[model samples]
Target: MSDPRPVPQYGEYATPEEVAALRGTAAPGSPLLPQPSPSPAVVSLRGSTLRRLDRPVTIALIAFGVLNLVQFAGVLLDFEGFLEVATKGTSAEPIDFTDAARIGGVVLFVVSLALVLASAAIAVLMLRQGRIAFWVPLVGGALSVLAWGVVLVAIVLQTPGALPPAGA
Candidate 1:
């Protein structure tokens, strides 16, 4: 009996069965079809030389660094006044302004200098994409936040007549 359909020639539209056969004939370990190009995100992540910091962390570091520098400037400009405001009602007896100002100014200067240095180091590390760059900002930002909280608490605690009297 004669076949019902004409035999398909090379380069003709292939049947599903013929396509399957062709796919099976491909050499082992070779793909039958070309791979799609990688997406932009994947491409960028590959073979990267520098480490990158998140935007929020970088901004926080810069803000804290500037704040410390500003605080240092304020202390330098008015050491006695800064001390008086810091110590205010927290103490019973009066503090010697001159002596305390000298000591407080030194401490503030050192702390602010350290903060600035840490900020600069973190910024460089971030640019270089160093692994340790992440931790530096995290720790520095936490410390900066804690320091600000303490200062705020001290100011609140010393607010003139904030608390009611012993009886009422």
Candidate 2:
């Protein structure tokens, strides 16, 4: 190793001035330093009505959310009875809409119920103002809106008289 020039050697006695400086009279190399303090940029959303739910409750809500909202679209779309001739002694043409609408309504209602639970979980997550709390709720709300849009499209696309695509 190269010798360090200006390096202090062992057995060197400390001066009274150096000792005082070390104690509290030390000069700072940089005078512009700021004292350490807690960060002031914190953000939070815990006050919303969604924080009351526990994990298991939210898990159940999520499951129902996916099931009801997701299936609601399929039911609204009338996937069944889309390609068939009128049966004898029955109404003209394929109009099997009873099942579709009922199922769709049930699914959507269930999802709406689950959304309440999801709201609770989201509220809980926000209590600490953790990074996740901010994004999770924002993203979830957007996704739920998108899912509703999809359901609307399904409803529009599959009116009673509408037919399914070929081979569907």
Candidate 3:
């Protein structure tokens, strides 16, 4: 038997209901439109509030720490040599590398290294939490300097001729 429906020259366009029915989302008689599929979600490893300074500050802090640690290590290895180089242009004289001075150098190195590591870790944590963390490195540097100064002062007091004479 021949089909009775007329053949159109143009391509057939299915209605919304027909399309939904074909997908089994709705009955062919229903007027509702098909719901759109959800788009993929995006994930971020770091917080959105990370400032431009965060990364630079962290790097600078680490660099400073490493440099300071290297210098401290050199001083610890040759306490008298470090003192001579440090006092070269100044009126101050290099003190004998006594046990006290060696101890002080060790203390300074340990404290400074610890502070640097701590500050970097804290800054990273703050960044992860979306907090402003630029101050961490600055504060750590200040504290490290203070600790070094205090230890140096104690060592100098223990060993004479570490500094220039009061008259000079």
- Per-model CA lDDT versus the true structure: 0.59, 0.51, 0.73
lDDT of 1 by residue, 56-102 (tens): 45656666677767766766556657766877787522643554345
Clashing residue pairs in candidate 3 are none
Model 2 C-alpha lDDT versus the unseen true structure:
0.51
Evaluate residue 51 in candidate 2 and report its C-alpha lDDT on the 0 to 100 scale.
43
Best by TM-score: 3
Between prediction 1 and prediction 3, the one with superior lDDT is 3
Question: In model 2, what is the error at residue 14, expressed in angstroms?
Answer: 22
lDDT of 3 by residue, 1-168 (tens): 665856545788767665675688875455675645444332122433356557777777767777877767877656556766787786765456467777777787778778988988988898789677878888998998899789878877887767667999
Best-to-worst ranking by TM-score: 3, 1, 2
lDDT winner: 3
Ordered from best to worst lDDT, the candidate numbers read: 3, 1, 2
Candidate 1 local Cα displacement, residue 149, angstroms: 11
